[model samples]
Target: MKKILLPTDFSENSWNAITYALQLFKNEECTFFLLNTFAPAVYQVEYLLVMPQPDETLNVYKESSLRNLEMLKERMQTEFSNPKHSIETISIFNTLVHQINEEIQDKSIDYIIMGTKGATGAREILFGSNTVFVLKKVKCPIIAVPETFTYESPHEILFPTDYGINYQDEHIQPLLNLTGNNVARINILHVDKGRGLTEYQERNKQQLESYFKHSAYLFHSVQNESVQEAIANFQLKVRVNLLVMLNNKHSFFENLFFKSTINQIGFHLNIPFFVIPTKLGKK
Candidate 1:
């Protein structure tokens, strides 16, 4: 069984993500951990100095968190009513990233499915700060569903890479599992920016081709265009429902996301982003 962690803040964006997850894995046996973390909005000097007993404010927040989690669980059962899926609720008073790290270790989480933006996220922003932090910090594979994105079978997946890192079975298992289950076609895209692929990159590309020989995959390349622009151009040609990328520090993925603001990068993702981290810790 797959262990998937879902973090919610009781927002429509979050609900949309949860709905997507349930539908994506409706036929499979899976356990979903519904997590919500809360902390005081502001810290008072007295509150910080003394570790007081459960205060009224803390109690109120904790109670609300638990109530919302239970309600969410009930809603999932009512809507899906799937015997293959089991729901677990977790309510805690801690930072979102911190608690997520703990849960990943404690539960051996396989994946995390969450919204790109939170309750207070702006319209133009592609990802909220929390989402960005998790993508950078968490090692688990994460599927960031767009706020208004409804459920769609990922018949075609677009994977953009520079062929920098050697592909690993463990790191790419999630992608393989998704495609194996959905019978989806994987489009491997590489953007050529004046210079050609190095010998190392060429070897990596050959290895990837071998890896996907049994699967339905196509290797695509475009010249004189930025990675972001190439992605946009390819999407225009192919109807891709899911976007996959490996978060390698030396790869263009890092330069595209970590160095600049998500929205300002000129690529606004309407489809779900399936990001697989190369390893745990900061990207």
Candidate 2:
């Protein structure tokens, strides 16, 4: 069965992501693992040694996580009525990012679905944290659903890349799984800055071309505009249902997303975004 790991903090944004994941894979038999990580509210330090009574704090957190999971499950069953779907809940009293990485390996997670925002605005800004951290750190593919985005069929997918990183089989597979004989049109968009493609970049583009040669895909290029603006305009003109990007450091994907303000992110992305992390290049 397909195993999907969904990390939640019991926030409305997290629940929005959960509902989107359920509907996205409703027709397929899948097991959804609902995971939540909690840390102690207070830590005691003595002689430069910090101690946390994990057991004391975790019991209540576990209870609350379980209850919320049950509530989400019931709502799904009542709304979708899908018998093939199965769900499991896990609560960990540890750092969120650390626990997520550990569980991704331990549980053999397939994909991660999560909320773009966290518990509070301050926590989101100063730390430059939350789902963005998960996206950069996690070795698996992540589908970040905006809190306000409603579920929609992925009939048209907008993929923006700079042809910087070489495409890998692992990176492409998850996207293919989502598209799968659905008659979805994949728009492979490349934004040029007047420099044009170098010989090396052309070869990389060919590599992508060879992979999706048989798939219903098209290649397009737009020049003289910023990557973010191009993508936003493309979505508006084509009415894309999903946006896909390969997050390569210093690439347009990174600049347009990683450096932008959180509230402004939705301005560019009205649809759900699937982020595939590109392996860092050796210096």
Candidate 3:
């Protein structure tokens, strides 16, 4: 069964993602884990010294979280009736990024479906904060659904890579799984850094080409811009239905996503972004 982990703050944006996931995987038997992470509203060092029982203060918050989860589950069931799918809800008191990392490992989660607002106004300073954090740290594929993005079959997937990180079968498998035997086009985009490809980079690209030999795929190289700009421009030119990236630090994915100010980044991706963890690339 495909295991999907969805984190919700119970916002309408999150609900849109949850609904999208159900429809995306309607044909397959799947297990959905709805997760919520909460931290205390306030914390003081002096209070910790004087008040020994922190659990007492957290009890109320925990209770409220459980109630919210129950309500969310009921609403989802009523809206999307899939007999082959089972839904489970979990609430934990911890940081969102840490809890997500732990749960992915413990539950063997297959994909993480999240909603992204894409940094609005002051929020642009920290672009895709939670989504970026999990993208960097989690050990699974993450499908970031843009807020209010209606679901559609991914007929064209735009995947941007540098060939810096070695391509692994497991890392690419998720995309293949989503595409199945459908005649979907996989556009492998590589940004030329003016220095041209090293022998190692060329060989890695070849290996990647070999891996997707059976699928209808193309490799294109573009020059004279930042990796993010190249990708955004390519997406507009190709009219892609999905964006896929392998999250690796020091690579274009990290530079465009983690290192840049959220507002400055121009991907403004309206389609689903499939972020595959770098560790999953390990053989």
- Which candidate ranks first by TM-score, i.e. highest? 1
At residue 115, candidate 1 shows an lDDT of: 93
Question: Candidate 2: which stretches are off by over 4 Å?
Answer: 40-53, 118-128, 260-267, 280-283
Residue pairs of candidate 2 with colliding backbone atoms = none
- Each model's lDDT comes to 0.86, 0.77, 0.81
Taking all chains together, the TM-score of candidate 3 against the true structure is: 0.88
Backbone atom clashes (below 3 Å) for every candidate: 0, 0, 1
lDDT of 3 at 149: 80
Query: On a 0 to 100 scale, what is the lDDT of residue 11 in model 1?
Result: 96
Q: In candidate 2, where is summed lDDT lowest over 10 consecutive residues?
A: 119-128
What ranges in model 1 sit over 4 Å off? 43-56, 118-124, 260-263, 281-283
Could you give candidate 2's per-residue lDDT for residues 1-283 as a string of tens digits?
7789888888888888989998899888899988887664463224113444455645887788678878877776787778789888887666677777777778777788987743344233312267767776777778888777889888899888788877888768788988883668899999988999998889989999887876789998999887767887787689898889887777776666567574455443557889876752111
lDDT of 2: 0.77
Pick out the ten consecutive residues of candidate 1 with the lowest summed lDDT: 117-126
Across residues 11-118, which tens digit of lDDT does each residue of candidate 1 receive? Answer: 999999999999888888999999998777685445544653546768888899999999999999999899999999999877788789889989888889999853
lDDT of 1 at 24: 88
Q: Which stretches of model 3 miss by more than 4 angstroms?
A: 43-54, 122-126, 181-183, 260-263, 281-283
